[model samples]
Target: MNRRNFLLSTAALALSGCTTASLLKKSTEDTIDYQREKVSGFFASVDGKKLVVLGADYHYVMDQIGDLPQVLQSPLKPRLNAEFSYFDLDHDNHVSGQVTLQLKGKVSDAERQKLQMEGFECKGFQEEVWTKVYKVRGTRYLAKGFELPASVSKFNHDYEIIVRESHSPGVKRAMVLLTPVTLAMDGVLVLGGIVLAPVALIVLSNTHWR
Candidate 1:
């Protein structure tokens, strides 16, 4: 190989190395940001008679419960939290589960009924749940597509979060799944940039230029 060809290959490898360095830095920053967000956020839950919460353990004991986020609002006081439950409202149990309701535009009676038949319940715009939804001009209704669970005299416990890990369950699971792939990517970057690229340059210069 000529000097020109060797120089071109070296330039290409250097560019590749720079790109991979940027990728590695970005990947690391993203992972750290995600970690910070997960740890900073809070979770609220009601086990049975008391509100079983990580941060807010001082709320009044209640004989009967009110709406979840409402009951939690004052006590939680400035910190944001999402309520989690083990009761399968939709009867579809997922490892990562939540009942998500979103507002739709101008839902007529017929449309409301159709959504209802499809296991969605429509709430009027006046409801607290629909407050954000009502901001949109045409969005008149909020739909939650799930069959409400049987009224519990006492809450049933179907799941538990062991306090061994600081990371959220979802994040922990994701990291476990992504670890191998992340390691493989790092290995490739290190090999191509640090080891293989230099070795290739030296070998080519010694043999081809002679």
Candidate 2:
């Protein structure tokens, strides 16, 4: 390929290679791992932080009704829900590893305990109001909230940062497990395979092999 065409091909191939990794990330965050379903909208750039969403989905029961599907439904299905995720703490995961904090704000003691039982650690210091705020926005199944990548100190600007959620009998935690470095490395591999391989061939073609 000519120089311009070759360069364009390289970028396209690199991005397309990222698609598979992105899909894998999506499946890991989904309750059902459906190829088309993704909860990534809940995630903002977070200044390109090194973080990851852990596990496939959330498993919990909010109350008696929440337990009914998993316990008494005709065709049995586990009571699983997708978590709403966001990056937390100024301290980087790359430097500090995973650390736990008391989840701030109005989340009830029982609800917090339930999440702790499920292995979710408290992430950030911000008020935990997304669930209540989301209920005010609009109703949807399997909801998620994404805070803006940047921080703002103003009260009126709250909407610009955290996403709101709807009301429901059940409570859920935003969980994560991977580092942003992992995804970055995946991109590097794709760049090496799809982009650099062809460039190396081009260079080799121009110079005689000794």
Candidate with top TM-score is: 1
Candidate 2 Cα deviation (angstroms), residue 183: 52
lDDT of 2: 0.26
For all predictions, the C-alpha RMSD in Å is: 25.4, 26.1
Per-residue lDDT value at 91 in model 1: 12
Candidate 1 residue runs with Cα over 4 Å from true position: 1-10, 13-15, 22-52, 55-155, 159-210
lDDT (Cα, tens digit) per residue for candidate 1, span 149-183:
22312212222221111222234322111101011
User: What's the C-alpha lDDT at position 126 in model 2?
Assistant: 62
Whole-model lDDT values for every prediction? 0.26, 0.26
Q: How accurate is candidate 1 locally (lDDT)?
A: 0.26
Clashing pairs in 1: none
**Candidate 1 vs. truth: CA RMSD?**
25.4
